[model samples]
Target: MADGILYGKPISYFPNGYPLFIALLKLIFSDALVPTILIIFNIIFQILSQYLFFKLLIKLNLNKELALITLFFVAIYPNQINYTRQILTEPISLFLLILSLLMYVSNKPFLSGITGFLAAQFRPTLIFLFPLILIHEIISKNTKKSFLLGLGVILCLFFFKILEYFNLILPPDNLKFNLIVATYSDSFNINWELARSKLSIIKNPLSVYINHLITNPLDFLEKRIISLWSLWGPFSVTHRGILEKILIGIRFPLFMFSIALFLLRKNLLSKNILIITYLPILVITFIHTMFFSQQRFTFVVEPFIIMHTVLYLYSFKGNFLNEN
Candidate 1:
């Protein structure tokens, strides 16, 4: 409300996905209604996303009963609903991601590609989902179709960048800034003093970052790994109070239990629905390992986490989770 919608340069520096959506609402309606409408729409979108996710679980051959259980957990999930009230990308990004996955599983590759492209615009890390989808297609022996879909998705992502290159859009170049900040800490807090001091001596931000990273690769890895931990689970988002605390308490153990089951079942090594479900988690993890890591930034992948957790506890049917 204060600075208005931000984009480009010294004043505001970020992608335009979430803000553009809000801006469109503001243009259509009144500014006063944007907040209330945004919150309401986000809640609705999240519910829809959950419904899609439940169907996805069923398609993956999870027991119908367990899929409903997973839907219940997702509907009531504290971390997810927490972002609905705020003017942030998490809600919409999550919605788009689930929609994309649903489209893909339903054999609508072109639509899935479009939805995934939108999700990545909201949260850049989600762009990694395309490669995972490509891998899934390869494994499913649909390489030609995956290639075309991926190409379309890539073109969508590069469209804006190409426009910017031609001086069409002026979104701020935040990559250098992100790299510079990464040298300090995994947290989003920018050490301006340190950054400014370093900038004073450096001619090129990218060069300095590359040199530092080359010299201290271990330190870079350590900070990113710790950041990923903070971003993934209960630590990432703020809890409301006692009720949320209880939910996290329940969720955490289930999460841990699921992880154990995932490994014991060798879900990653197997060529099945488990691998398809698991690959996105790895893709997002690797994306954060390289970019600015945060809870809200990676919220797009929460459904996958919740799905696997519930699946593990329920144990659908056969020895294999994937009926395909």
Candidate 2:
């Protein structure tokens, strides 16, 4: 798709934000060099993400040692390193997401909103949490900042509309497909014909979901539960190589353990950090439960998970004993 775009072909599928970015790179350099360039950029983004994450921790007043430890883990994280070799949106989206949070915590709302908008373009899953952030700003009486943030998002939307009008890119048209797919467990083999039949009538994904919930509540609940588990499930043993399997096996347990500790010690953490880190994880998890869930979808929030977990461990030193 990116090659097609580079060759001046119209993108008939979903909006090609990430692909467009890749195509633009290909335009600047030879096609053969594009892959290498992308990999390097991914690595750079990963490093910058770590740096921004450390800054975020400091801004939240977390202990320097704990923040450094979290930074080390994020830098050496297997999935983060592995993703740098692929031409996927994860690395860039993760960087932008972390940067957006950092900007927000630093009270740079306009910059935060702009970065957040870009992150959503690369990974639309971020869209689910934007409203929650806006609401938080309003509730905290940061009216001026909220307005600036809203304006930033609105301006981005307007630019997108202009590009869409020019037929440069198409808006996402996968909600029905995602909604249909969400009805089944990741392990289920889907019948495309039956899926298409359902999709043909699904004008509203929420309506379809509600109907499914009303008609077959148990099946709906079961499938959603399975989807939730799949989001955090370890990499497949049969499909992945031994090293990948071993790395994920170790990482999976640690991720879960951290999450457990975060939940238990959340009260000792900063509310701003909680809103920026913990809430997005929950929002994404909930969104995936209603749509299609995948382990890769969790990548965007993995850093936050690490940050929350490390902050939780840091709390045991009684540093936050006076915190409400």
Candidate 3:
């Protein structure tokens, strides 16, 4: 809640990796420069992401008109743009995830391994893609190669974790409780701690699976819309009028539409993005249980998931295309 807590001290909003990223940047530049550079970099990356997405469409054999319209929609996705500017881990992680995916689509397994390694640093959950990548290896009959690549990724991650320790970037946080404390400083929370304790409902398959289906719609909506303004809650308490409530409640319509299109896409059932997008979600929900609940936390994987929707929309030959 305090600027002093976030900027002056260690800000622990997420895992140690993102904080490590911030620390790495600060080692080379001043704080004032970090935000400015991040803002500029994000804008550039946003444009590049648009271009690459269009290129991806072209690769998938979409028409030029269709590809450009797709690009426009992605470019104007306000929630995504806000995410890009936040100096957070999601943007770069998602970018690299898309890169690895593109490389995979282009017949480059090695590059996928490399990009996935980089993306893992931005979010540990990225490792969940290993199963799918392993399947790719098996499909290619390169079992040994897949195993070794995965091993290499694990070793590299360990190397970074070790380096972080040597540099004292990831000390006490290696202990989950301390990490949570470091991630977002608050005095303490009886409610969160209680909810986190009861997260074991996930260990039971029937309950977890059933609850996931029943709660997913509301959970997804609340996590997206309500999560945003909660960050600055004390700062903006009285400002939650109807429109603000809607915005805060639902993320952005484009993002929701993107998600909708993805879920409806029949092709996704057989797509590689399933591992990168859908399965990780199940695992994450189980693991986090009741501990944390924010759309942004899950949003790290949104773009890759979004591609499925975008691709599906393309198949429809629909007229949702925006005029530029």
Candidate 4:
């Protein structure tokens, strides 16, 4: 279905206007190898992305081995593998998203804007980060120039949203944001989130922020007790029973390592990219899981989650790290 719309003569399954840049190229070439070529280009992007991530990781004082391990995990993440073959937005979105973080960390605020704006093409939802990043700029005591560039980035997103609204050009769907999930959730526990929002307004806000930080998860566990352990393996879909799926859910836990690194290495501020990358995802998923769906909503965080999972593996020497 995705391939046909991308390669065949029709619209895509979802409103993936962002990928049309590649699609139009495929259309112009009119070759059966279009998808192959697209994937190949993404492969190049993957390599460059590794280098970029490594550069940032190194700058942040992480061990090189940790950086490599992180890159490895991101490379093989299963959901990414299953999705990249078609016109889906996940692959490119992952690339641009990470690039934005790398750019931000390297002190190249303008490039971050460009990369982040490009990311909006993959997932317009990133515009949500503007307020947060502005908070970062203010907290960091950035130069006025940096602050302006940050606003420029937000304006860039606004421009894209306008383009999408007019149908003049299709950036990703800014309007596609799930308001029900972002604002209110169906989950039984609202205590932490309610506290997080309130504390953002108070003096000495670190405690509440820390509490929110401690609980934020970037995992993709299926909500089934059975599937959680088997989540990434071939066995996930094999168990068809409702009760079994529920069992699988509990097994899926988030990458739960950022705080450990923050503490063990005393790297709380240096690892801001990791923090920035995961927090919005946590908030978004918390709402959606409560109000709309289940743990699979974790896919929103898949790209960064994979990156961290990759990094975490290097903590121990393993056979998995030796593969191509």
lDDT (C-alpha, whole model) for all candidates = 0.67, 0.76, 0.53, 0.51
User: How does each model score on TM-score?
Assistant: 0.80, 0.87, 0.62, 0.59
Pick by lDDT: which candidate is best? 2
Steric collisions counted per model: 0, 0, 8, 25
Ranking by lDDT: 2, 1, 3, 4
Model 1 alpha-carbon drift over 4 Å, by segment: 1-12, 135-141, 158-168, 188-204, 233-255, 267-272, 316-324
Query: Which candidate number maximizes TM-score?
Result: 2
In candidate 1, the residue pairs with backbone N, CA or C atoms under 3 Å apart (3 or more residues apart, or in different chains) clash, namely none
TM-score, cand. 2 vs. native = 0.87
| Best of the two (2, 3) by lDDT | 2
Candidate 2 or 4, higher TM-score? Answer: 2
Q: State the TM-score for model 4.
A: 0.59
lDDT of 3 at 8: 43
**lDDT (Cα, tens digit) per residue for candidate 4, span 276-317:** 556656544444432233333344465455545444444445
Cα displacement (angstroms), candidate 1, residue 156, comes to: 2.9
Rank by TM-score (best first): 2, 1, 3, 4
Location of the lowest summed lDDT over 10 successive residues in candidate 1: 1-10
Full-model lDDT, candidate 1: 0.67
